[model samples]
Target chain A: MKMDVIQPFINSADAVLAQGLECSTAIGSLSMEEEAYRRKGVAAMVWLTGDIEGRIIIDLDPETAVRVASKMAGAELPESDSLVRETACELANQIIGNAITALNDQGFHFRVHPPVMHMSEEGIKSSEDTEALVMCFETPIGSVFMNIALRYNRKRHADAASAGH
Target chain B: MEQFAPVKRSKDGQPVRYLIVDDSVFARKNLARMVESFGGHLAGEAGDGLTAITEYDRTHPDIVLMDITMPQMEGIEAAERIVQSHPDARIVMVSSVGYQENIVAALQRGARHFVQKPVKPEVLYEVIKYVLGDDGAVATAAGAGV
Candidate 1:
């Protein structure tokens, strides 16, 4: 069966790009999405619940990460790592929150798990030995990758109301 | 985030429906917001990989938004299981698990997309569009279905 799922994320992206950012800039078309993640980079992830569950990975390099951090921190330019992480954390918070709102409208409500920053060099462990999906994008800064995995065998909507997700 | 029912449709030769998955309460709220804007519907959702599998069985999500770390079932483990169960399953690793190394590990684990935190909506949407082959749109997704 086919399903309608694009509108949610699209709207969220548009809203975040235009409204959430302090100074929105042109991200442009992933010109070379083919090479979206040829090299390593920085990535952020969050989990989904209710109706559907998985992960959301936002990948970017240090350069782009720093630039995004600068804007997120309301800075004309960045010089400190703490400043960048703060902005990045906030930026992640807003974007991820908006994404959840978008999905919620789709009849799939789920609360976020939290935002974690990784350098990509650290190995990401797994539940089992198998493959996964990597949804990659080309940002003006560098590349953004959103990876996903299989749904394990467990109960359903155990905590649907408390989280409002 | 508001609660709504997921929309179901007939795929024109479609094999899988990718799901946006994560563990953070804040992140999930944000993601649900984005999904609602898409077409007012979602296949299913889960907190960890373990539960995700159950949800996946019901909805059979093709692609997934996977976080690298979490309680109970981590994204990587979930990815492996989902992929192992369904080879065609597209699991996108959505976490800031690292830069280069995790990306490769995710790829090896059957992950198709790898992104970092502080997600950009456009970037995320692009991954969904590319992976899902530009199919389906969830609108306000009015009427609670959850």
Candidate 2:
């Protein structure tokens, strides 16, 4: 994926964590993985269309999910509670919402579906040829895992579009 | 420093009733906390747009804080339906999707105002006051958090 696409998600996640949760987050090491992503305790998927045809996956363990939810709720909640799961989804939604705003400001028109939660045992399996950019953030609550995997190989088109059309 | 005086009571001595509609419990609870802090009562709560419509009929709240993305029906649709049935319904769109299209659509559908999610207390307070025509509390939201 292009830096333009990946950087916004990273910046937005940082902003959302700091502004929304009042917690400063530090960026962990980054890695590129070309493998199927097995969903952990909770995963939120935001599908993108228009200029970007792919999805952004945010995964967190139950402990991290509970901590994040508790902070957002201003009260502690058990991992089994439905509200915890909703909080996970909302976090992803807000982060992507911010990212979309940045992308749109850069003249990239992309529409995102409402963030959806996946809790089934079966995890998300990326296509074999897809290269996923995995970025990790260490927050006061816990670690946040973001995977940016694009199915479209439209780098040239995106590059031309970014050239101030 | 400007302190928020308690809402005390409305000029008519009646409590301002609010119905909060959101799919997230965190959102509902947080907004409810804000309402109570401002001396308003949460008349009811709905997790989706469909329930919002039914709850609107039953609760008849003075104001509605609606979330745009929901499973059954979108917030705009619900606002339209409520406005169709009761033209005086005071509905506000509170959403994370701050996209222009969605915001414009909600405003066109009879929503009195729009406030993006991750809402600050002062912004919400200002919006609710403005929508309810409470000019006394209609100060600019900026610098009020201090």
Candidate 3:
């Protein structure tokens, strides 16, 4: 994916975290990972369809998830509550929402599926030929990581989307 | 303490009753908190668009904050259903989707306003006040957000 598409995700994360938790985030170095990194405490996955095909994964520890949920709810959330899980999903939704909005403004059309929650420990697996950019962020509550792997079929779908205008 | 009633009013003579509908519990709670912080009352809440319709009828809230993407039914359809029966229903879309298509669809479906998530508290306040036609001190209450 191009920086234009990827930067929106980064900016969305920054804006969402700041608004939801009033916490400042220090985004770590960005790296292209050959293999999918192991999953952490809680993760949310969102699929992109239409002009793009791929998934976005957001990973966070349970503690951080609880804290973030608590801040978002303006109340303390228990560790094992489903609300915490929903909070994680909504967080991912917001990030993807922001990204797609920017992408649309840049003349791209794509739709996102509802966020799915994964609470497993085996981590996420990346298939060969599908490269992903992994970025870790440090927040006051805890750390958050995002993995974005998407392929835009520029010739086929991009032209069809742009031609409609 | 006065139990918050349907279409509750604030001391400043503004209607603060609100019904929040979103599949995400986090979003519902966040919007509820923003409403309450602005001297508003939480008339009720629903998790999805289907339930939103029933809740709207039950609560008769002055304002409704809806999310576009949801299970059972989407916000646009629910807004249309609510507005079809109640022509003057004031519904505000609070969704992560900021696409022009979705916004236009929601407005066409009878949504009075649209606000993107993660919603800044100040923006939420101003939009709520603006939609309710109450552009008073509450609009500038929180200059910290947005």
Candidate 4:
């Protein structure tokens, strides 16, 4: 994926995480993955379609998910609480929504879907055309993982180009 | 959450009522907390735009906080529909998607304002006050009306 496409997600994650956690966050790691994704713990996935097409997943370990949920809730929550899962999904939603907002300003149009829990242990393998980029953000509470796999809609781009001629 | 001077209806001095619509329960809870801090009342809540219309009819809230992306219907269309029936409705588009196009579309369709998500209570408080305009009054610390 182009850096222009990926940069917004990275920036969004940093800003959203820092604001939500009420502390600074650093990029712990970044890498590309060709294999299928494995769930680290609690995970939420959001899909996008339009000028860009693909999915993004936000994953967190069980302990971190609980702590983050509790902190956001302003109260202690047990690991079994559903709010933990909800928190993960909301985090995904906010992160992706913010990222797409930036991309939209750069002239990309897309629709953001509501987040769903990535309950399965395994995810679809990345293809050559859309290899997934995994980024780990280190926060005061814990590590947050973002897996983004996106590709430009070549047909749409081609159509626009031809129409401009 | 930091408390602010209560925003009450200028006509009756009652707490301003609000309808919050978002698919995420977590987001709804967070917004609920923020509105409460501003001394506002949660007249109703909706998880989607379709329900938001119904809730608006049932609750008749003074203001509506609507999210953009949702399952059945999006926020902008709902805002338009609501405004079509009640021309005086005050709908504020609150979403993580705060692109200029989306903001402009919502405003043209009848949204009174737009607030980006990961919302700050102070920002939302100011927006609520601004949108309410002459129709809203801030209560003094001594419980006197503004």
* Model number with the top TM-score: 4
Candidate 3 local lDDT, A37-134, one digit each (tens): 66866889898887667888898887889888887776776777676677779999998998888888877778778888865655566666457888
Q: Looking at candidate 1, what is the lDDT of residue A44?
A: 59
Top of the candidates by DockQ: 4
TM-score versus the correct structure, for each prediction? 0.43, 0.83, 0.85, 0.96
Ten-residue stretch with the least lDDT total in model 3 chain A: A121-130
Best by lDDT: 4
Off by over 4 Å in 4: A75-80
What's the lDDT for residue A138 in model 4? 95
Q: What is the lDDT of candidate 4?
A: 0.91
What lDDT score is found at residue A32 in candidate 2? 84
Per-residue accuracy of model 4 over A1-165 as CA lDDT, tens digit each: 899999999999999988887889999999999999999988899999999999999999878987887777666767764777888888998899899999999999998888989888998888999999998999989999999999998999899999992
Give the better candidate number (1 or 2) by DockQ. Answer: 2
> Which ranges in model 1 have alpha carbons more than 4 Å from their true place?
A1-165, B1-18, B134-146
Candidate 2 lDDT by residue in tens digits, B28-84 = 887887887776789999989899999999999888999887777878999999999
* Candidate 2 C-alpha lDDT tens digits along A1-165: 678777888998898788767879998868887766667567888888777777788888878887887776666767775665776788887888778777776766766677787666665566664578788888877888888776543774677769964
On TM-score, who's better, 1 or 2?
2
Write the residue-wise lDDT of candidate 1 on B1-146 in tens digits. 22322332225422234465665544554565655543334577776778877777778765678776666887788888888888978777777433455568788988887766555656666676566553532223463221
RMSD of each: 18.6, 5.0, 5.1, 1.4
